[model samples]
Target: MKALLILAAIAIAIPSFSQTLESKQINYLVKFKSTRDLQTAMKKSVMSGTKANADQKVEVITEQMVLVSGKNAASAPLLKNQNIEYVQPDYELGLIETFKADGQDQKAQVMDYLMKNPQLMAKAKGDNPLIPQSPNSGAARDPLINKQWGMLDMGATQMWPVAKNNKTIVVAVIDSGVDYTHPDLVPNMWRNPGETGKDAQGRDKATNKIDDDGNGYVDDVVGYDFAGNDSLPYDKSVAAWQLLLGGGNPGHGTHCAGNIAARGNNGLGISGVAPNAQIMALRFISEKGTGVTSAAIKAIRYAVDNGAKVLNNSWGSMGEDASEPTENKALRDAIQYAESKGVLFIVAAGNGFQGKGYDNDTAARPAYPASYPYSNIISVAAIDTKNQLGKFSNYGVKTVHIGAPGVKIYSTVVGGKYSDQPIPFLAVWEGTSMAAPHVAGAAALYWAQYPDKTMAEVKAAILNSAAPISSLKGKVSSGGKLNLVNLMKY
Candidate 1:
């Protein structure tokens, strides 16, 4: 047993202290050189369809940019077309929706143990009525509350006194989509404050086919869908990923959102870490669990342009699948954009490079968005109930900032459309995906406590407030997992 433990310690090597096109889009992002009028040039030379088989429709993502479709070999001449600066294939990005936050069996056993021990359950609830009662209690109004072990692990119960009233603080859940209809989640979904009974001329801003907020989107009362190019960012239903009764639920965004801000004290489903914080649903990933970087970029812009001060990214690339991590310019630029706007991006460290774990501190091995060097970003790794690093979580002592409870986390699964039988509890879901929101929720609370601080200050406070753990000393930069109790006191 001693030898096995030694080998396991050796393998972890913690010292590292570390697409866009749209759904099924075969596209490339091209920028114009020194172009003043990008749209005019694109219309005249490319999208006009008058330029020898240029019938392809182009989506102008920004000022001088275009996510052009209808080409694989067709972009070669266009790159040389005097007006074009450069172009590259719109790479397809996938979500890390699966990982080893410990197996569901382990989680089940833990729950059984807790169930047998009422002492632990009572201790988990402590004195936070803002946090609902645990499951299995005749008195537990919300049966799913006890199932939410992740909240207890991160000290969310302790943070509630400071955050239960700040409904104006918004965190962008940039993934598939959130089930806004979920009773536990609806009250906390971010509503466009600009949405009123009527515009100056009496036209309904929520329904009028006009850009009421002048944010370039029409009738986007909740959030925008970059994947389908629609106004509603609600998680669209999928037969395979639905959270059917007695079925394995897979609504990625909804699950993440629930972890961040599902309403507490409602005696309904599980409680969220930041129940008072609002969620701005941004659907960039498709129902199929894949999407292009362009859509993600657009979603980031939308979130920042809106009132989302903290961005919770539960999905990322498989860095181990390639020779090294791929640096995406459009996506990097989007992160920079958010940083410039005082928006803090909380991202997951990643599941693995490609099923092969590695140290993130080494430049040769890294994760996108999370590993990207930025002050506004807070990279997160997954830890189990034991406070030990998860076997499947990627860590970098210098890169991955902190750790959080992720194994078999229970939260709100998609109810309407996204689910078949409406499983109120998304039990046993795992990954760094579940961990990022724990930090996001805390960040929202911290921002509320210090609404005057800049995004950088909030990021630093969260990182500096982590409770260092011996097991994770060399695994994560903070050498600790999230401790909301410490965060609030700090």
Candidate 2:
């Protein structure tokens, strides 16, 4: 027995020695003129070290290659032999991975090495696509004002009375991008104090340039255009009639953004739940209202990293098939990371409400991020004015945590662009997608009120304060619809 125990300890000790001898983040970045060159260089790096046991991994990210060593050793010789243009240590982004010495660090190191050895820093910068300039006028407000007054008249008025106006808390809209230059939106836009752009002097003035912020985006002066994968401004567009056959063209995201926090009371079309909160639009979905798991993950990470305390994800699928555990796992990890950073994620339950035509014994339909056990995510369902569940809204006593108004809702629209005119506001879109933003906007209001509340507490306030609705009783977990007035007490 003693001999066996000693052997076990030795086995463990071997891996420990390998781990300790190498630095925590001894990662490398090797650059090639093209992906083909990168592949060749990677093969050479691996082959050069027989018994060296180097591990190479492709970056899920674009524009780079990463190679990690199972055992630490200098990579200079291998890189030089491969005719690689550059090699460097990978720098990490966000506080979470800065010590990993991975991807970004390697890029920086390669750039630095080239500058010192080959004067490569003088190369021309990449051309950034032009972002569409937003108009100066506010969106029309008649519809939003009506919604605001209707909510207020219906006893849903818990918003900060006008006295608490200039709090300027940041609300990150993790959906399609926003029209930042919109006249009304400009006043409430969140400007990064740490961010600088060029001035009229042209003497290296601190301006919001594409490269100036150094946050992996150029001149993200308004917000990022992640779908385009660049800072260039683009509007979300629905595919032609031949494509979707039913859904409207791309403006869902803009409409949702306006619902949450379009400039309110500026004599514009409609008022957002929290008019004072600064909206930081983070576009993840394409104009078609569809997005991949990877883009969703990045958008969530970007929002949390850039000071967005509340994240609004009004899109989600009705859970994965039993065979797709891998996709579920990735989503679970990403959500856990977001919660760890103290960001609240609000997701929409799918719209599949034609009662399954069977008994409830079957497993309740599940929604991806919402159904995931992350403490910050709050899944929402849609309800109509009659306090009845919408025909298309998904519901599960065990899965859906709350309900909100999603029927025929009015909000902002994109491409309402006009000369010296505010964007047009639209009314009467119906979907669970519309309902999710109401909850998200309320979350912003709650977070603004209790800035220090944990994601759990904020979620609790939302669930606990909802107004009971008979129509949704057995279908919804809480048997209630959202009630901002009741939540304010907390």
Candidate 3:
């Protein structure tokens, strides 16, 4: 057994604000009554003495929404324009796991407990090896498969043979980015059809620096990185200290992608719930674990416009802000657009900031995107191996829909590594951030089997197929936990 020591409690300041807004220059997202109304709103701003200058940058996020960045972009005249529906600040967003202090504290507590109980840590490490399993086990051969209690509890392995034969479904991982080079994830990545062949000059279209598909992005072979402003959306790793400071990328997107779709039955690493699905890497969050609403909107639209059938949104805001009631409108519209196009947006139900799960229905403010009341949204909460809700998870009878395995979820990370435990401790790699992907992967698996079903039908199938769990009763609307075998049968 490894020797370990518990540390004394240390004081840490928890930020009250759920989402962050830019501080340098005021950036406003203006949604017009129509696409043509942008010119009129801009003119109204300048004529009304908003001090328009060349320093200002105008980016068209959608046909009706434009991001205006300038010193006085928030002038009343621009917002009150008859042609404009509403104007709100563009918030700097982070991964849902990084915003909560209790979520991080949970990691510290677990580490301390592991230190005090070295035997448990030693057992966990010894039981979960990174080598292939004995063929006589009659299960997945991935060496570390035993540690993925989540997959075992959900019956993901049982549906593997059926899922393997179905057509691939594209799910957009709209978070940090994906390590597409990871051997387990590489086989299931979505490659752009337009960027794969040779260009006009016989140069490789992927590296030719040309927008071959003319989808407005240049050389988006796999997926585009709005955060890094590049074609390759690779999940970048961060320093341990940076994660401890609560402002760094912890290979978040890669982990989520692996949970949704790591290749199966190849005798390599772990398999995702929907091993046949393809991941469309869309990076909107920066390495600092922060991104803006504009980038998020772009990624959503891109996913919908492309062939993506489902979007795994594992990041979202906590509470409501009185000052920015309208801040959610932009995201709401983007999600609504996805719904209109028959796409499912799976989201995390969010974690508590005070060290335990909270009821979102009665809270002063519930989580957004999850609680957006959208028809296409499936809000997921986290459950442990014992079928008990995680202390750091959030739940709501009407808001949160179902529970999935979130504790100690083992999957892919950056640099071809796989772990449920991360250094500097981030939710112990737990939280709804880990839970939502299970549902997303389930959605993909079900959709691949029922390709002709509508998004609403898919949502219904998943909810109706849940396996009732006593602990989840009255907490999630489904009153049960995610059952992949049942979902596949549907």
Candidate 4:
């Protein structure tokens, strides 16, 4: 059963459309007063040629919210009905930063760099490329930990002892699917409990093709793929041809997942801030790194309904459009749902246009979800190892909450690989997208240490513990960069 919203409560102020729906067909998200009202609204649609026509095009995401693929001709009339609260286009959103430019491919640059530097590749493949970690230091022994300047700068070294052996918390990477099999991430991947054991018929629940957990999904051992609408949410990395034609993912979600909770001190790769946290992989963005609004909402709801305590939303619209507020209303509602469930939503402040930074405080249209006025939201900005805000990072003293290591970030990628900075086109990897998971992992780390804290309390501690930094001053709400040691102390 889907959750029912109170009649008196509208998800948010539904902004009126500037013009009538265009005649062309497109996907539109509609919010009806009730499930029963769906039929009544169709009856009232002037373009509803037939009941079957209406039924064929509608995809119900929730009892009240639906994704309709048809012209505004049918939906334009829906607004007249007092029961129909909101209707708007289902906008297509993509990665916060573009990876290709001027015939240069970011992935190509990475491959070229590796090809020219076989020695580095050889070292990458070595079982133990560096000196082993001293046991009493309480630091990770991962071969690449030294390259993780961001983690070290955030005080990961000092906090590791306290975070190690703590309760494992689940943090959902709500983006492209994760490479759950990555050597660095496999040990900390989330395994669905209900789908682990044998079924009533003595069949293995994980492979029995049954909804063993009774959670509307079948054998979701880790997480579901909302984009592909199937079970396996693996990160299908882009091929050479796909990149040439300008499409396919760059292991964005996998990198984010590694930052949140790659296994620590495992002697394989780097350690995340919360090495013990479990990464719940939820794929909403397609392989091309773009996703529709409905899919994003479903991913958020799924993360909350499951056991995820933190949601790392590293993708969003390039910028806010006041006229299209209704288009993203469903997004707000979904996030509100997470908030009601005591889940913290850590969002990227967004990389500005052309991969250059911008000030959200005075921009005509600021990045959203990050700019959204939600209590549970902790909008993050990107900063380099020097504690300087990334030139490509967006900032807002009031909107963006805090700063975190995002520039030249080193973490896990697809194909069981690790890179300090893979996509090299105009510093594509240096984005607030990378910054958010730092906070997400930190949230998990802090929560693990103090399980009694509420969502608001954890958020407060994280923000309050930010170390006042000159670069981030007057730019983010916290006026500082995240300090994990200070946060753990709090």
TM-scores of all models?
A: 0.79, 0.66, 0.84, 0.84
Q: Which stretches of candidate 3 lie over 4 Å from their true place?
A: 1-24, 39-51, 75-81, 99-140, 164-167, 325-327, 424-427
lDDT of 1 by residue, 285-326 (tens): 776566777788889988998889999998776542242123
Q: What is the TM-score of candidate 4? A: 0.84
- Candidate 3, after superposition: displacement of residue 375 in Å? 0.6
- RMSD (Å) per prediction: 11.0, 15.7, 9.3, 7.1
Q: Which stretches of candidate 1 lie over 4 Å from their true place?
A: 1-26, 33-40, 43-55, 76-78, 81-85, 99-143, 162-164, 200-203, 240-249, 320-326, 353-356, 363-365, 416-427
lDDT of 1: 0.68
Better model by lDDT, 2 or 4?
Answer: 4
In candidate 4, what residue range of length 10 has the lowest lDDT sum?
1-10
Name the lDDT value of residue 191 in candidate 1: 72
CA lDDT of every candidate? 0.68, 0.55, 0.77, 0.76
In candidate 4, position 117 carries an lDDT of 51
lDDT digits (tens) for residues 363-398 of candidate 3:
765676678788899999999989999988899999
- In Å, residue 83's CA in model 1 sits off its true spot by 6.0
lDDT of 1 at 83: 57
